[model samples]
Target: MYWSVVFPGMTEGQAKWLLPRAEEGLPGLLGSIVDPNYFISLHVDRHSAETMKEALLLLESSDSSTESKGIARGLLEAVDDWLDAGGKYLEE
Candidate 1:
C-alpha cells in the first residue's frame, strides 16, 4: 500500500501485482527485511505506471470550492508532515 502511494516510478497495478512477490522475496530480494518497520518497492511496469500517473495528473489539476480546497490542502499538509516525520498511515 505504501508502495502504491509513495513509491517512485511504480504504479498502483504494479504495486498490487508485486504484493505477493514482496511478501515472498523479502529474505532474498534485498539482502534481508527482518526489521519490523521496513518496506521495499518490488517492481513496476511501464504501462501501469503511465496509467496511474495520468490519473494522478488529472486529480492534481481538478478544481474545487474554497471549503473543499481548504480541507484538501490541510489533509495534504498533514500527510506531508507525517511523511517528513517518518510516520505511516495505519489503518485502524
Candidate 2:
C-alpha cells in the first residue's frame, strides 16, 4: 500500500523514491502496534524521521523552480509537524 501523498509537480521518479521511504520511515515517527491479526500498524524512529526530513529539505533546496521548492517545503513541514505531534493512525 502506498502511504505517501503526492504533491503537485512531483515526478514519477520522485514519487517512487519518496513513497516507500516515507512508509518505511513513518513507523519510527509514529508509534506502532501489532494487531490480533499480526499486522504491524506502525514503525519508525527518531533517526528515520530525521533522515526523511533531511531528504525532504534537500529536495526542497535543490529544486530549480520556486513552486517546486514551495511544494517540497510544504511536504517537509507536514512531516515535521506529524512527527512532532507523534503521528496518527487511520481509523477504520
Candidate 3:
C-alpha cells in the first residue's frame, strides 16, 4: 500500500524499487514505471497527448538514464502507433 499509494497497481516491491529513482527527477519518475504494457495503457488511455508531450520534453531536458529514457521512448512510439491506427475510432 505504501508505494501503491502513488501508482495504484504496483506491488510493494515495485514501489520500493522505484522510490530512489523517483526522488532524482522527472526522468526517474517516468523511468520508474518499468512495465511497458502498464506504461502504455496508463498514458495512452488516461493522459492527453499534450501531457505526454510534456513528459517527453522532461525526459529530453533532464539527464535521463539510458534504460529509463528507452522505456519512455517505447511508450511514446506505442502511443503514436495506436493513435495513427485508431484515429478514426477515437471520434466515435
Q: Between prediction 1 and prediction 3, which has the larger TM-score?
A: 3
Model 2: ten consecutive residues of lowest lDDT: 31-40
Error of 1 at 32 (Å): 40
Model 1 Cα lDDT, one tens digit per residue, 1-77: 23333445655567667666876877544322222236544343434444444554444567756666565556455
* Candidate 2 off by > 4 Å: 1-48, 87-92
RMSD of each: 13.8, 15.4, 13.2
Cα RMSD for predicted model 3:
13.2
lDDT tens string, model 2, 1-92? 22533265655576566666776876754322223355423345556667778988888768469888887788688678867876544332
Error (Å) of candidate 2 at residue 77 is 1.4
Clash-forming residue pairs, model 1: none
Error of 3 at 12 (Å): 18
Cα displacement (Å) at residue 79, model 1: 0.4
Q: How close to the true structure is residue 85 of candidate 2, measured as C-alpha lDDT? A: 76
Better of 1 and 2 by TM-score: 2
Which ten-residue region of model 1 has the weakest summed lDDT?
A: 28-37
TM per candidate comes to: 0.30, 0.38, 0.40
Better of 2 and 3 by lDDT: 2
Q: lDDT of each structure?
A: 0.49, 0.63, 0.60
